[model samples]
Target chain A: MRAVGEGAGGPKSLPLILARELAANLATPMFLIDAGGTLVYYNDAAEGLIGRSFGEQGEISAGQFGEMLQLTEPDGTPVRRRDTPAGVAFFQRCPSHRVLQATGYDGVRRTVEVTAYPLFGTTDEMHGVVTVFWETGG
Target chain B: MDVGVWGCRGSLAAPGPETIRYGGNTSCLDVVLSSGHHLILDAGTGMRPLGVMLDNAGVDEVHVLLTHLHLDHLQGLGFFRPLFRPGVAVHVWGPASPVQSLSDRIAIYLSPPLFPVRLADIPSDVTFHDEPLEAVAIGSATVRAAKVTHQGPTVGYRIEEGGASLVYLPDHEPSLGVTLANHPADWTSGYELACDADVLLHDAQYGDDEYPRHVGWGHSCVEHVVDFAAKANVGNVVLFHHDPYHDDDDLEHLLVQARARWTSAPERVRLACEGMTITLDANGVAFGAQAARA
Candidate 1:
C-alpha cells in the first residue's frame, strides 16, 4: 500500500480512492463500502454521529455496523441491512435516500437522513458505495 | 519482469530529423514476464514495429492493454502483425465506455472505410475485454486497471509480481485545476494506480512554461509529473509520453529541470525513450541497461 489508512488497508480501486478523498474533504458524515459488503471507511465528521472514530472501527460488516449503532425505523422497529440507504444502493446499484432513527454508542438516539449512491468505474464496474448522512432531528 | 519502451512520444508521431534521437512513435510499451509471456501497453505507431519484432521472434500469444481510444494510441492496431496472423491468441483489453461496447468502438478504426479489414476479418483468435474483473492474472503478473485523469475514458495499469510493481499512466494529468497537495493520497487521480510501484511511467508532455496554455488538455507538464512521482514515492520515475513538439534537446532540458526540482530524490528520475527497457525483481528497479541512449 502507498499510504496507510486508519482502520483499513489503502484502497486500490480508483473510485474508492476518489470517494475516500471526497469524504475526507466534506464536513458531512460519510460512510464507504466495498463491492463485497465491507464498511471500509467513515470520515472524521462521522465520529459524533456514529459514536466512534474510524481508527477504532476499521472495516466491519453492515450488520456489525447496524449492531454498533443500533439503528431502527422511526416507529421503533429495528432496521435490516437491506433496508438502509447504503444497503439499497449496494443491492440495487441505485441512489437511496431515507430518514431513520439511530441509537448511538453513547446512548443518544437521533433521527437521520441518509443519501447513498453506488460507485462505478469508467467501465461500469462496481467498486462500492458512498453514503452521506446528517442528523435531521432528535 | 522487463519493461521495454517501444515508443514514448505523445499526441502524435513526430518522426523527423529534429526528433530523431527520441524517435517519433506514440505511446507503446512492452513488458515481458519471466515466463516469456508478453504484455503490450498501447497500440500506438510504435506497436507496428514492436509487432514486427514479436512476429519474427515467433511469440504467439499476447495481451494488449490499451489506456484509451485516442488516435495516437489506437492508430497502430490495424498494422499490428499478430492481429493478422493465424493461430495466435490476441487478447485486447481496454477501458469500457458506458455507451459503446469495446468491440464496437475498436471496430470504428479496424473496419471498412478506415481500413480494408473488419475486426471480424482478422484471422487471429481475438478476444476483447472492456472490463477486467478487477485484477486479472497473466502468467506471473497480476494486472489491475483503474481510470485515471485523461481526455477520454483512460485507465492506468498496475502490474505486480514477485513483490515488484510497475505502474503505467502514459497519458495522465493529476493536477488539472486544483493543488494536489490539498487532497489526500486517495483523492488524487491516478495516485491509487501508481502508489508505491517500483516503476512509474507517467506523462510528462510539457514543461511548466507551456502548461498554462494547455490546461485540461489531459497531459502533465514536467513540474506536475515530477511532483506527482515524488508524492507517490515510487522507487523510480520514468517521464513518459514525450510531447511531439519538443525536440530531443528540449527533452534533455526538461530532464535537467526535473532533476533540479526533484528535492526528494533527483537520481531516481529519468526520461522514457525508445528501446529503454527496465527490469524489476526482488532486487528493485534496474533501469536502462539496454537503453538506446540519446
Candidate 2:
C-alpha cells in the first residue's frame, strides 16, 4: 500500500498525504469512502459529527457503516452505500448533493448537506469517492 | 438583478453568532429590478440593511410586498429607514386573508409589548393594498401573486417585465397536494410557479433526507428544487433559505451537486448567497459577486 502511494517522497505514502491534505482544511465533516461505500478515511469533524470513533468501529462496509450512522432518507428509505449521495455520484455519473438529516448514535439528528465526487486512478479506472458533509447553519 | 437575503430566519428572529452568516433576520429580500425599481419582498430583519441602502441612495418611492404576517416576515419594518422618510411613499401589498388590514397586522408587532413605538409614528406616506392573488402592474412590469403552502395564509409573487421574469416564493413547501393541485397549468407545481422565468428563487431549506423530518414545514428539499428547475424550464434556479448551519464551502458543494443534476438546455442552478448578483438577458444568465459598495 505504501509502495502504491510513494513516488519520489521516500517512504511517505503519496495517497495518504493527498487524503490528509484534502481533509485537513475542511471545516465540515469530510471522508473518503471506497467504491463499496466502506469507511476508508475521515476528518476530525467526522468524529464530532456522527458521535463515533471512526477507526475503532472495525472494518465496516458501506451498508454497515450507514447503519451505524442511522442514516435514512426523508421518505423513510434506506441509504445504501451504492445509493448514498456519494455512491450515486460515482455510479450514476452525476453529482449528488443535498441537505439531509443524519441520525447519530445518540439519536440526535443534524442537518447535513453532502457533496460527493468520484475519483479515478491513473488507468482511468474508478478508485473511490470523496464526500464532504457539512452541518447546516453556521 | 441583485438579490440580498437580509433575513433568512423563519417565524421569528434567532439572533446569535450561529445564525449570523446566513442572517437571523426573517424573510426579507431586496430585489433590484432591471428598471431600477426597488422591490421589497418582506420586512423581516434582513430589511434593515436594505433600509440603510435605500437611506444612502435617497430612495423615496418603494414597493413592499408581504407574503404573510408571520413575525419573521415583518419584524424589521420597525427599523426600516425608508418608512420614516418624510417624502417617501411606501406601498404595501399582502394577501386579503381573514386577518385584519396589512397595516393593522404589522402594527401588532410595533406596539408596546413588542416594541416602544407605534406603526403610525413612521413618517412615510404608507398605503396598503389587499386583494386575492391577482395581477398588478408596476411601470411596464406585472407583479402577480398566487396562494402557496404555509401554516397561516400565504401568497407568492411573479414579477415580469421587458421579457424577463423573476418569481419570489420564499415561504413554500414542495409537495404534490394542496398547493399543486389547485393552480392552472402554468403556476400549479413548483415547476409551474417557475415556468420559463428568468430566475426562480424557491425555498430549499432542507435536503432530500431532511424532508421527512420537516414535512409540512413550508420549505422544499434541494432535490425538489432541482426537479422543479428541470421541469419548469427556467433559465436558472437559485436555492434560497440556506440552512442556518451551512457555510460558504458547504454551499459551494451543494451548487456543484445542483449543477451536476441540472439537465436543462441552457442550465442554471445555484445556491443563493449574500452579495450574489444575477444578470439575465435574451442570450443567457451571468452571476457575479455584487460590488460591495453597490
Candidate 3:
C-alpha cells in the first residue's frame, strides 16, 4: 500500500518500533501477563525457559505456567499456583520472584527465581505485567 | 592470557600445618599483564597471605573479582589487611545478585553470626561493582567472565592482559545434566568457559572412579579436567579444587594419569600448588619455571 508523502517519508513510529525491538533483545526471560494474569507476550528467552511457546498457546493461567515450569521451593516441595510468586505478584499488584534453581525439563523439578510486576496503562489503569526468572539454589 | 593460581581449595578454608605444603588457603589468583595491572580473583582465605604480599609490595589499589557469594570465597576478606588500612582502595566486582548487589553480598558475610566486623567497619575505601559477564576493563587488564556449570548463579572468569589469558573455572561440574539439557550448547558438550586459553585452572575434586558416585554434587573429576582441557585446546591445564582427602602424593598420581593423555597428543598439564607463580611475557605465554613454584 502506497502512503502519503509526509507520512511515508518522515521518521514516523521510529521510537515505538525501536522500543519494541529493544524489549525483544533482552537476554533474560520476559513474559507479559494481562490484568487477569493471562500470558500475552513471551520473548525468545522466556520461550526457551518454559520449553514451549507461551505465544502459541495464547492465554496461560498462573497455575498452568507454574506447573509447566515445575516450580518448587528450596525444599523441593511443589509450589501452589495460588501461592506462587506470579500469582501473589498479580493479586498484590507488585513485583516478586521466590525460590530459584537451575534445572532441566518442562514441568520437572528445577531451581529458578520467579518474579511478577503489574503493568499499567497510560491512564493509570491496570493493563498487564511481566515475569522473569533464572537458576539458583546451589 | 597471562594466568597464575595463587590459591585453590574447596568447601572451607583448610589452613593448617598439613595443608602448608599446598598452602592451606582458599581461592585466590593473581594475574599480571605486561601493563603491570594486577587482577586478584576471589578473596578466599588465601587473600590473607595475598594481602600481606601486596601490602608489602606497596600495591595501593588492588582489584578483586568474585564468582559467587559462597563463604569460602569471602571468608578471608576480613583478614586481608589492605581493607583495614587507609588510602588502599580495593575495587571488588561480582555477578549481579537477585536479592542484593555485590556490596550487599559482602556485607552479609561480615558482622554478627557470620563474622565479628562489619564490611562497613573496614577502613579502606571499597567500591563494589555488579555487572554482567563480559570483557571488563580494569586498571590495565581486560577481564572476561563466562557463566559456568555450577549449582547456583555462578560464573567463571577469563582474565587477560599483555596478550595472556588465564581461565578460572574453580567450581564446575562437567556432567551437569540439567544445564546440558537446558543450555546444551553452553555447558554440556565441554566447558564453554575454559576453552583455548593460556592456562586453565579447573575443579578436579574427584578421581575417575569417584566421579560417578558424586554426580550432581557440583564437582568435577580429574578425567573431566583433562578432557575439557584437551577439548578446549588450552595451553597449560592446572588441576585445582583438590579434595582434602587426596594428599600431595595422591595428587601426583592423578597428575601422572592426566599427563599420560598428552603422551599421544602432548598438552601442558600439571597440578596447582601453593606459591606457584608463572610469569608471562609480551606474548601472553608462560615462560621461565613452567612447573608449580616451590
Using all chains and alpha carbons, the TM-scores for the candidates as numbered come to 0.78, 0.61, 0.64
By summed lDDT, which 10 consecutive residues of candidate 1 chain B come out lowest?
B285-294
| Winner of 2 and 3 under TM-score | 3
Which digits, one per residue and each the tens of the lDDT, describe model 1 over residues B139-194? 99999987877788889999998999999999888886557655456557888678
Models ranked on lDDT = 1, 2, 3
Q: Output the lDDT of residue B125, model 1.
A: 94
Q: What TM-score does chain B get in every candidate?
A: 0.96, 0.86, 0.88
Superposition error at B99 for model 2 (Å): 3.6
Candidate 3: lDDT of B164? 68
Per-candidate Cα lDDT values, in order, are 0.85, 0.66, 0.66
- Candidate topping DockQ: 1
Q: Which 10 consecutive positions of candidate 2 chain B have the poorest summed lDDT?
A: B178-187
Best by TM-score: 1
In angstroms, the error of model 1 at B87 is 3.0
Local error of candidate 1 at B37, Å? 3.0
Model 2 Cα lDDT, one tens digit per residue, B1-294: 455556655556656655544445567777776667777888877788879989999988888888877777787888899888899989988866443666787788878989888878878898888732447776556788765556566777887766778887777764533233232233233344467888888777776667779876777777667766656667778777666556545556666766776754424676665556666555556777656633
